[model samples]
Target: MARPGVPAPPPEPPRVGITLQQLRQSQGLSLDELSRKAGVSKSMLSQIERNQANPTVAVVWRLATALGVGVGELLGDGRPAPPAIVTVPAHGTPTLKSPDGKCELRILGPIDLAGEFEWYELTVQPGGALESEAHEPGSREHLSVLAGTLEVSAGSDTSRLKAGETARYAVDLPHAIRNTGKTIASALLVVLHAA
Candidate 1:
């Protein structure tokens, strides 16, 4: 089975059809609804959920974002979380880049806190910005600037924070963080979810 100068194909990702279908149903989302939310075609989603097709990474990411779950969760065994202190090394943390690719958010929270709360180490390149949609009602976000300056806008209000400064605001409405400074900006963001 060895081919000269040829690499073996990568193994397939875990089948996620059943898990995707179950999650959609549990969330009371119809194929059309999920399609609209995830920006994927209904036919493609149907195919993926039926295991008829292996989705691309972009598709999986869109679906995961719509489902409010991580890609790992989508591909993982659905198991109840066990009580334990989780440690994530900097290099091992998952990072998501903004659509523009100018900002990066490193997930710094444990998996168990996924939907309820999250912590992120956010890095914004000069003139970069991270915009977010509205979260669940009563959700709040706290940001502590570690370097440079940041401009934060929540709903109709906007504020600026410099290094060593902190800002807390309601995130139930649209929010954004922009690095208006010439240098790169880094910050720690903590999101507290509503019960």
Candidate 2:
């Protein structure tokens, strides 16, 4: 309850689950068709839609890429999609969302498609998770935890990365980056592309 002089806190943000369904529907694809394209099980996809399951970042990325959308689209605000070519300035770049809803992403630089890979910084709030779906073929990712602790899940493996620790995994493996620590967390993600 708000005091007469104090204002009430903002309402909780809506939970974001399986915005993937929106992507699938927008693309006119059946769950099975999307399953085939994303290499995710239809049952799993169904669970994700219903919020019964949380897909790893790899799985999430793959689905988004198959749908030809940004990872944010799969984990999103359900807004109308804009044109191709998303240009984010040094100060105003779009974010890669965390499903746990406790983190904020800052896009620091341009996506260098000309190079073999790109990098981004992710700042995680206490109890936040960034579940990035899988990426396209031949792509991989490398992450280094900068502060606090993080839970890194890739494919069937899951590990905790403390400060200064790093791990690299295939982008096709459903992956998730989660802040398991009580304090704030940050990480550097290096995305590598396949030739």
Candidate 3:
């Protein structure tokens, strides 16, 4: 709150559309090309560029992946240098949830390294599962249980894990981390993509 006679802070400028357009133009990419690469419709891209549409988080993630840039870079000025020490507030971290709403994943890795390597703090309610399809060939994941008990399945193999236990498994095939315990479960999950 501002004191009497004190001015309030200025509002932040809208930058998403501008930044998207600039990145597209700077990369010499046409609307059709970007749409194809980002797996977004050209019409939607045009709307986004014209500030007529506000994209969802999934759309932004796809755009960032196609541009080979971080989500922050797409949302802010390009690739700003980090300070000696950087702190991202807990609330500022991005999160993804399962469609069933029983599992939540807090993204913990820098977006720039998303495809190569990524980490997440995962929480699953009792009887919930974090299931995933095959990843890129040779991709692997490591899960270190932090609370409660969980079960991990990679292809045909499965193992139960308790707090303080870790499991490393290939994720190129179908995989899942299920919380079959009576309480919530937490784990640190790290994924390493193929070369």
Candidate 4:
């Protein structure tokens, strides 16, 4: 059913491509103003929009609130489609070996979360580690140990996450992931950001 002057609906946006940037710009906001209003770091918001990083739910909430939108607005209805999960291809296995020989993170789907953050699967070699330097503000993160054991260190606090165990924290926590058990370890990571 096409209207007289209206064209057919264009293809749907991939899950992550719908970022807050589009939403904010639609409302006529500048990055600096949005950062100040949302209380998130300007750099971080830029990263999220560029799909340069993943953000957490909490950070999503902040941006949404500041924008007068709902968290669902960020994740969207999964609609135009629906809540869907995408996996990486075998040939796409990441060549990003860990410098610490500890762990490697392979992004599973579109890092953009379309309005949210990117999600990934982290594979940690026994005694492996995941590290990253400080990033922009308004970024949130979550982790779930799917198989094996994972030791997560955030600042001065440490948490041992076991199989089927899950945890969520602020990306500002300055954390790292390590595998202490025998055998390879894997987990799911969801990152939300202002971008």
Candidate 5:
């Protein structure tokens, strides 16, 4: 709704646009190949490559992983030279939410290390659960509670951790991080994939 003399604001442009075509071409991957590898539709991949459509962070993550490149590279931020320090503002970091919307995972690790080694700040609202399917064989996770309490279940085993406590367990089987407390629970999670 608009006021008597007020006009509606213009629609915002898509957030993601980068050198996707160049990266795909350099890797000798056709749209179909990349689509299959990234689990994206061919049309969507084409649109993204042509900068005709914007992809969500999850899509960007998948594409970067499929291309074996960093998210920064996909975003056209090439690291031609090593810098002494690189800082990313908090607001610039990507975050993923669980389907139920009660759990949030702030991606803290670089996309380039996604499959091999990754970390995230996990936040779960009371009574929320971050259920996860089995990861790669021999995969493991280390979680250190930062606030409140969290219950972790790996396979048939379960453990509870409070602030300042850590738990390490295999992620090769189905697992879950649950906040049974009345308050939100946060933890620093690190994942390591087998070579």
Candidate 6:
């Protein structure tokens, strides 16, 4: 498939181990801590970070998840940065489904805001609930219902919000949002991280 007098494309560079090490350190995570969060053995992670071992796809996936980054961010070519203006179409947005499969959340914010903050469009089927564990201290969540009715509960207090209603609550304690109406519930949710 080569054209006359044209050179073949250069091969991809070898994976750089420093990327992983830097990310872990920047997050103030030790090898043991990252191992526990990634579900990978500490020894294996050590090896990978030292370029002594080649990680499998699953291992890389777990590491990416633990680092709160995409796998491409780890293996991307070490080239100059591109322009800052980025666009994410609706079809390209990342989505997460609840464990029970009755709720869906579409990430609407930039990926760089993963930890500091996040925005999402959440949809819950009737009779479904989205339960969440306590977030970082001082973190809060704001939800504005766009359709149907939602029961927002934080700890012992619960409130009902209908279409065009909004509620803000501290998320440092266990919380849940249940769709109490017979129709699907849609809401815009913004989570602010603790300073």
Off by over 4 Å in 2: 1-94, 112-116
Better of 2 and 3 by lDDT: 3
- The order by descending lDDT is 3, 1, 6, 5, 2, 4
Name the better of 2 and 4 by TM-score: 4
Q: Judging by lDDT against the true structure, name the best candidate.
A: 3
Task: Give the Å error, residue 193, model 6.
Answer: 1.1
Better of 3 and 6 by lDDT: 3
Give the lowest summed-lDDT range of ten residues in model 1. Answer: 78-87
How do all models score by TM-score? 0.56, 0.48, 0.59, 0.50, 0.59, 0.57
lDDT of 4: 0.75
lDDT of 1 at 192: 98
Candidate 4 Cα deviation (angstroms), residue 79:
22
lDDT of 1 by residue, 114-144 (tens): 9799999999999999999999999999999
- Every candidate's lDDT: 0.90, 0.78, 0.91, 0.75, 0.87, 0.88
For candidate 2, lDDT tens digit of each residue in 1-195?
899999899975433354766667767899899899999999998988777887888987888888888777666775537545555566576676655568766655565553476777888897788776787777888889999999988888998989999988887767888887899988888888787
**Candidate number with the higher TM-score (1 or 3):** 3
Across residues 87-182, which tens digit of lDDT does each residue of candidate 5 receive? Answer: 889998999999999999999999999899999999999999999999999999999999999999999999999999999999999999999999
Between candidates 1 and 4, which one is better according to lDDT? 1
Candidate 6 per-residue C-alpha lDDT over 1-195 given as tens digits, one digit per residue, 9 for 90 to 100: 678899878875556367788778767899999999999999998888788987888888898899887788776553313425556788999999998899999999988888789999999999899999999999999999999999999999999999999999999999999998999999999999898
> Residue-wise lDDT of candidate 4 within 24-96, one digit each (tens)?
8767899999999999899988887786766677888888889777677677743323224445577775445
The Cα error of candidate 5 at residue 121, in Å, is: 0.6
> Model 5: C-alpha RMSD to truth?
19.5
